[model samples]
Target: MSKLAWLNGLPLEEAKAEFLRCCGSTRWAEAMARARPFKTDTAVYSEAGWLWSQTSTEDWREAMAHHPRIGDVSKLRERFKASGAWSEQEQKGVQGAGEDVLQGLADGNREYEERFGFIFLICATGKSAQEILEQLRERIKNPPALELRIAAGEQAQITRIRLEKLLTSP
Candidate 1:
């Protein structure tokens, strides 16, 4: 059977768990689970985006907490084992990065969290380490309110990608 069919057939709690794996917000997961029996892949994507847009800053922070600091491969492997493999794959550009770039990401992540009260979030699926670091530096300069919205947007992109991955996974 198809993945979407499989998802639609899952128990409510199991469906919520699957959606939670895509995005960490409990509210979003629950909403997606309840909004189940989606008619098409497009419907799933649309609902994910709409639900994300409706989320509060608190919900965004809850989702953001699920991610490890960018380039922190060890933490990804250890602390975030549940989503570690997906994160590591999304951040593949970090692999074999030079020490200076890695250190910059580490330092920038600290500064970002200190400034914005959350981790530096980006859709790292296709971005290189240097590119991600450049974004981090530029985004760090944004005001708190603006940064929060930008982070939420990035999280939305990540959630969409994860949802696609989920539907395509064997």
Candidate 2:
């Protein structure tokens, strides 16, 4: 998928397939499928955000589960290999961050899940562990509805990144 895929007049199924290839989720795939025949890349991607807005909280959580926590790189095989893309930036967020902050993040993640029954999702694209931890601490106070919306926005960021990765081979 290149800029050409984003171009208008691509076959409807072809557009839908591209979206699914980027992120293989049922609702999102269908959403992109239904929104097909988009006249511009911005329009297609704009609707992608709208589609995420319509996703159920559970679905969003399922997506978040795909990501590993900061500093825990053992499980994410490919993602870890790609760590070069994120390591320095993410580590800087935790630079000089003591054990207490790490423990607090661990606790916060547990408490947040106990309250919401899902992981606290964030766009870790260029963020360091400390940045993500601090954000988690701040977001813990948010009411459920607000937090869900915030998580949705984060998911949008991740989805957009994945979409770009799928469209661009590097």
Q: What lDDT does candidate 1 reach at residue 156?
A: 94
Per-residue lDDT for 1-170 in model 2, tens only?
Answer: 55634534456666665565444455786678777666666776788778877788777766665555654443445553433344334334555567877777778888888887677777776676677888998998999999988887876876787665644545
Residue 50 accuracy (lDDT) in model 2: 81
In lDDT terms, which candidate is top?
1
User: TM-score of model 1 relative to the true fold?
Assistant: 0.97
In angstroms, give how far residue 70 of model 1 lies from its true place. Answer: 0.3
lDDT of prediction 1: 0.92
Clashing pairs in 2: 90-128
Candidate 1 lDDT, tens digit per residue, 89-147?
A: 99999888899999999999999998888999999998899999999999999999999
